[model samples]
Target: MASRSKLNQICQFCRCTPRTELKKCHKCGSVSYCSHACQREDLTNHQRACRVAREGVIIPPLDFLKTRKEKERLTEILTHCVPRLLTALYNDLARWMEAKSSALLERCINDLKLRYTPSACETHVLRVVVSRDEMWPSSTSTPGELFTVTKFQVMDVQYARESMVLWKDCMRELEIQRREAKANGLGMIAVVGIECPALATVRLLQFTGVGRYLLVTPAESGQRSHRRARR
Candidate 1:
């Protein structure tokens, strides 16, 4: 057994002595981190090992997640499309979308503005709903007791373009709300959804204890998660 003085107590990420006790990796049990933040910062690298070891199935590296190349069309929408929509919320494009869908985008932006930083509201406020069925991804589509019984149809965007128009309107509307909010208090931002292949990485193996759940869809995988996703 190693002597107490000779024990390996260094943090894996910063390589500095942890202010508090270092926490061991729950999955691998071979590494330690100072905090969840350090573990998160090193996750991209860690996942390369952890995912495969945890899940027996080999996963290809995600190209989109790797390249993350700028979408030209998305940039085009920010530059030109949004302002046009703001001029008339009930214009031709709005006519194409269901009223509830448009309102949902606007409402989410408004709610986020209450929490998001001013700078984040300006930049991150423009978000697109990637999840199907609803903007917020849910695990089981089956109605829970908490699910509201409403007569209205839940809107899902079939094409990225369908969400884009409302996203644009919501983006511009947030700006307007921001200006008006300075006179009151609330201000913040999401409305940029784009079309890209839904590529993902596989990280499971029977040898490793990682694949606690199957990564079938965004709802089943990481989209709705908070802590698991931060890793």
Candidate 2:
């Protein structure tokens, strides 16, 4: 066996003391820290680097994609293709049994139906439907018909096990749908919208294989309260 000294050291950020116990960063095994507090403090500086490390390559967001055509293209891609890719990646990470496919899909569908509206202190949920033309040929009879619908829900906390489970289920469905679409020559895309803490968003991104994620804040008017606190 290799000597302990020869092994890669823990990140200074996660490690309490580099001279002794070495705890690596859970997100990116790169930078070392001594404690959660240190890791949180270093996050402001590590955000950009951590993103690059996780993605393997930096993709600068497109400024021009604001146009109608770009929007449509994006919608198609997300609704039709992204989900499957995420599912495949998630499967590779956790060798979950394929037998749970039906149950997983049903659970996702039910979750979509729950339809929790966003209110003060509550996360918002939205569903984006991809049109038929965007779906792979096998699933498309009419090009402009509904192809697939993606559901998104936001939460305030950081890395809740329940939230992670939901994300995993969504990813699995996306993967299955994408594969089915491809086999039948149909396009697959997915879109998600959520209102949650930035840290929670980052955790979600790292856990899920979705490459495109947008963090939106509630409007200022919604944030302000003309009336005094009730309590």
Candidate 3:
């Protein structure tokens, strides 16, 4: 761990701390930035440690992929693909905000910090389909997709117990569809919800030519929301 004086030193990107109030990186709870622009500038370099810190708290499910080969592929994505995607996503987010996405992300991180543990906040379900290219792939093209995602968030806040119920519902629905698709030789769909302290992303993935589908739900049960002391 860095010394207090080191963390208190000017922005992580540039030495501007003495001139301004510094804010710590909420995700890692380490390193401080004097401004959003400095945070954005330092993001690329900061992410290596940022990801390490986040993963230290929440290990990504690398074993979610069924086969050894699939697991390896997923590992490759987590190692190479995810960082690039996150960079782009963060950059886009930065463009939209007056204070930039880092500030927004900090607020979100703090909002869920006490109430949600990383482990409790993530869920993924997988099913096998017959054909890969047969289903509608886009969430926009598919009706009720947004509504379903929104409803999941609402459930997290309101009917927290129903979070598992919803997951089971999605699982059962996928199973039924998988069986039908297998009989007809068709493709499957998956919903993945990952709510990172730094960024919350719910993705609906459709493989163009694969049989496996995964669903990740964004709901964390109320039971788990009870705060756990940091080890």
Candidate 4:
């Protein structure tokens, strides 16, 4: 049973305003305070919640295209190895698909660009199909071929997890590369995808420490799209 307050008070530590009685800490439930100011005063007991709350916030994606400095850095990275790596990846897949060369690679990159750009049509189908009846050639054979469909399915899940881990690693490496580029007075571009509000807050904080930020929402069609189309 909890006693009701005249006005529902939020916890100063976690900023949680309970609709009902504010009896316990929403985060740790270790200390109880009636108002936000009171919760802030209890530094000793609420420190854990403060730290946890900080970590819970999400960071938004970077919009490197808007910043000239960021764009330059990103271009440098793309110019070096990234585009080549992507080309190789696409070429390998296309080779497996019995395509001539890496012409499809450019198409895949265009599709990725179209997918990211607002108001762009989504007609590209990026799918990989494997035939069970046909025996895979030695060059195309992977560990996935030996296992049965059920086992291969499990392996595919594991591979997806590993790929996500690799993607995160690539992001970290890119951040380091961007920092180096900035040190040399070069512009860099970072494209980030923020799914949650917490992520958006975290990204703002992170970018603020690095440099200034100008928030840009997805632009609507008309003038903006016409400009993008021309570019």
Best model per TM-score: 3
> What does candidate 3's lDDT look like per residue over 1-231, in tens digits?
878776577677887646556888988977888888888898977776787787763336554567889877877877788778667544433333322222222233333332243322122222111111322223232221211111123124223224543344444554465567657865432222222223443222222212211121224322223232121
> How many steric overlaps does candidate 3 have?
6
Q: Which portions of model 4 miss their true places by more than 4 Å?
A: 1-163, 192-222, 228-231
lDDT per residue (tens digit) for residues 104-144 in model 2? 32232234332232121112123222222322223223222
TM-score for candidate 3, please give it: 0.25
Better of 2 and 3 by TM-score: 3
TM-score of each: 0.23, 0.22, 0.25, 0.20
Residues 143-182 of candidate 4: C-alpha lDDT, one tens digit per residue: 3442122111111222322554423443455457556766
lDDT of 1 by residue, 1-231 (tens): 867633557777887775577888898676788889999998877775775676653545453543344445554565577656434322322222332333334343344442233233334432222212232323344322112212222222233124544333434454565467556743222332321112111111011111222223434333544444366
List residue ranges in candidate 1 displaced over 4 A.
1-7, 56-231
Worst 10 residues of 1 by lDDT: 201-210
Question: Between candidates 1 and 2, which one is better according to lDDT?
Answer: 1
- The better candidate by lDDT, 1 or 3, is 3
The collision pairs in model 3 are: 10-17, 130-186, 131-186, 131-187, 191-215, 191-216
Against the hidden true structure, what lDDT does model 2 obtain?
A: 0.40
| lDDT (C-alpha) at residue 152 in model 1 | 22
